[model samples]
Target: MGRHSLPDGSAPASTGSRPGARRRTIAISTGLVLAVAAGSVVALRSDLLPFGEPCDGQSVRLDVAASPDIAPALDAVAKTAREGAARTDGRCLDVKITPRPAHEIADAFGQRPVDPEFQVWIPDSSLWVDRVDAGSGTPLTTAGTIASSPIALGAVPEAAKALGWPKKTYTWTELTEAATTDDALRLGVADPARSATGLLALARINAANAKDTKDGDEADTRTAAAAKLLYQRVADGDGQVLATLPRDDSGAEQGNPRRNQALLLSEQAAYAHNTGEDGGPDLDLFYPQNGTAQLDYPYTLVDDDETTPAQTRAANRFLTLLSEPGGQRALRRHGFRTDNGRPDSEVVDAAGGREPQPYSADPADPPSVKELQALLGMWTVTVQSARITTVVDASASMANPVPDRGGQSRMDLAKNSLLQALATFTPEDEIGLWKFATYLDGNKDHVELSPTNRLGDRDKDGTTHRDALAAAFGSLAPVPGGATGLYDTTLAAYEKACGAYASGKFNALVIVTDGANDDSSGIGLDSLVGKLEKLADPKRPVPLIAIAIGAQADKSALDRIAAPTGGSAHRVDDPSQIHQVILKAIMAAGSKGPR
Candidate 1:
């Protein structure tokens, strides 16, 4: 089962709609130039087939929206349709087109189901279908023109030559080992958050690392090693550019191999870049020679939301077109080949050709519902990572308040917000509470897990861990306290609370002290960090984090600990903003790859 309480960063809601009549943006290559200039074709075609009454008399209006994140192949598809090749059942075609922001599409699935009335909603990849299913709707029909290019090295001729590419071959192990030895090499990919392709690239790397053992587990040593490699590159400033990029942008150096970039680009962009007009840096796609994984973007027909059987039938017809001989021929023109072809067949040794193999996915085989559930489950471990050994300012000087949710004391607001956030848990995520300024007492440093009694999950023989944790938070009385243990408390939690679950889930050391630090100096903080770092997580410990509420926190200390350990030390000028901010941070924590 997945955890409750949506964390903030998991997926930011769409802010607003773009101006203009919405048009679907499909990734298409230039089919032809406009009659006037014949030179404005940038890259990818942009065309849409006109809609009309279905030849079979079925009024199936498919409002197609391409994932705005990917370049629209609309023009390519449109040009084909204009040639009368897109007719359904040997007649005209009818469909409306609209373009929504990429983020909006991710959000849409979270809120409402794609209109079942619409015959089909094609995102860039079928993997997105998995994410969309995780959210709303009785999943709709999804299809893709081509699956992603299995990740390969998109390097300059020199880089490829140096790696023994076209001459030799590369396996994931070769790449990782090379990076470990030579720190200057760059690997490209798109931002995981921005592009599903990048995320897949990351997953592939993780799986490659995980190949040693196929134990059906959530995380493995290889994944942790890969994440550490990524984070180190991030912490090492912008120096790790060539080593890591989103899976997509790892191409001809993004016109700046001189100055490394943080994110990667999509494989299509990488291909286009190496072959573009300004593209002569000697580019090559080094397919890892030893059995690489291909993303099989299977197109499935949605039958759940149709008025009549004809509309559904029409949708299936489209699927048929995608797999038929003509469609397969079109796929080859766009650099794809039918899966059956071997590296030996007419499968031109080019961008999108290779033998086809059965993917670990099937609309019915793997059960998307189960995968969606798994994604959410892994996500929960990321969010409730650490329970801050929160130390609120309760002294006489701290009594004044700031604006909070509906105007409440900053301290009280902080308490309520923390309570609400704690509520977003499965017996797995837990937190600790403390109040301070002059004196500290009353279950300080007490960490409790969320109780899952509602589902009859007996984490503690009969009591839900959440209930136990809730009781701990409730018992946190604002006693007259002073002098927060900025670093010491954090160090304490490393040993005291979070240490218990360090290996299983993310166990963080959180501190919500008021203002600046009083005693936790550099030397003391160093000692604390050293101890925390030395300790690996428990068999399944959650992550740890520290928060500074209304000052009274060792800024430097909190920052350092959270940085490497997958946590954050946040400073709040106004107390009322506590709830939303903490929630947001939790969501960000969810985005981390396993710790």
Candidate 2:
């Protein structure tokens, strides 16, 4: 999950007003200073700082950085620990806890030298630990989890009751469809790529979508549809989603009933949001019937050269303290489960009298690393905006009238379908236009109608690229003497995509054609495939998707051409299905190139 900073951008209150509180206050403030300076955090400065602080030489100071949401609770524990804290072989231990965003610390470790001040780190999810380990190649020593919170669907009582919540079990498919297809229900989520809760929720949705997949493309297509539907309603951040939620009816204004219909959030967040609610329309946690993902707040010790054996022993002592019954109770006050994954009775009573029932979240339900990478790649192109070069066939065959539609030509249907498909893309997504046929642009088989750029962008002439591209689409007239130039045009398009690939965007080439190569001057299929394979680069991938528009379209030839670039080819006989086909193709694109 992305880091949740302190609510007011201020550190937690000092546990006491005595000398110990003052000492801790300085430590917290100093830790924040270091975090600001480093663009990361190593919480709780050691007494050795300032070069002359009075401290017992035998005292072990362990600096611990914790997730923001749980930091304060941990801070409280640290305060109690100070009076008579755990000892390592008769040596006094001073444990300090500071709130830090896990992402920044991970980035710091990957990009810079490690600071010796930080002895232990406790990120919200194991996923963040894995990310740092993968990047740094330095193993982290972890003492299991301190607390856990299951990711759940938070819905207003009205919506939950309407769906038979508590009384009925609902699958992720039903929730996804309701949020995406139903006009009345709005599903809001944070960006899955950034939020663990959102990522897990999406995993459930994907699992439900791909349950009966007979082939990879079918699975990709289904998952894409689900992602696209949910992407539309996402808020900018997790807090925003929580903030929009309706409050309990103490006659208080919670969230917009019209806007905040359902949300994907952690149980801790839900409890914090609806503190006084009891099965009301404002806050009800629904553990999906399909299962869920939990955030296991693992206590990890940094096992690098910077860490000493003394600090390691101190970390072990602290871990033992956190797992004790008293420590578990303190963590439960923050809405996390006990070490064993069961809700604390006090916590259950505090939220309401009803204890949250156990659902089917098998430990392995969370996506594997490979699955996560694929999903993230798909999200980049389909849900998030992308940079795409669209190549359309403008050969004589494109001018043929549709078989059944009144008087609509293949070009007419194709243009309309392409425009409709464009509607699914965000304005931030840059798209360029190209048209192809034999001898269409001097000696070239394809002509660039507009440079690959954002749609709403303007030139010196003040004409918007979107308007210009739409006009270009409207004005296209199939060349009467033209023949399909599939191989040459595809090669040219791929070159253009590569030359203009934006580093941050999902760059791709989308080709829509109604026939196979017929150009005498174009290279043969064998030569084209070999050339494309040689040009393919995983580091700078440019996936090519070929869309065959009719029965006469050559699927085998298109598939063979697309195979070399880790792209895919799809055939759609009906123009109405073009939108769905385009979505599916985009999901599968860029997922299988050089790497």
Best by lDDT: 2
What are the Cα lDDT values of the candidates?
0.44, 0.68
- For all candidates, the clash counts are 94, 3
Q: TM-score for each prediction? A: 0.48, 0.62
> Alpha-carbon error at 443 in model 2, in Å?
6.8
Residue pairs with colliding backbones in model 2 are 157-281, 246-255, 247-254
Alpha-carbon lDDT of model 2: 0.68
lDDT of 2 by residue, 1-595 (tens): 1111122112222210111110011123323233334522222132211122333556778899987778877887766666553455455668888887665575566444465457778877766666555555345655456777777777777676665666665567766675567666667887766666676677767777778566665676677778777787776556667766554443344344446767888878777766633333446666665666677776766766666667766675566556555566788777777645765666644432232334434433456655655676677677656898889999999988887889888888888888877766666889888999999988889998877889878879998878787787777778898999888999888977887777777778889999988987779999999989888777787888898988889899989988877788899876656666776666556433221
Q: What's model 2's TM-score?
A: 0.62
User: For candidate 1, lDDT tens digit of each residue in 1-595?
Assistant: 1111111111111111111211222212322113213522311132112233234443344445554422244324433443443443344444454544333455555456544434455554455555555555344433233333344545654555566555565455666556444555655444444444444555555455546466533233354445445433332211123334322334544445443332233334344443345424434555544444333333333334333444444443344334444444554444433443223223234332222221112111122433333333333333224333443444433444664445455556666666766654444444445444322434342222331122223454677545665675555544344544345445554565543543434444445656554443323756767777766353333345556665444567678877656667778776555655665565455543342
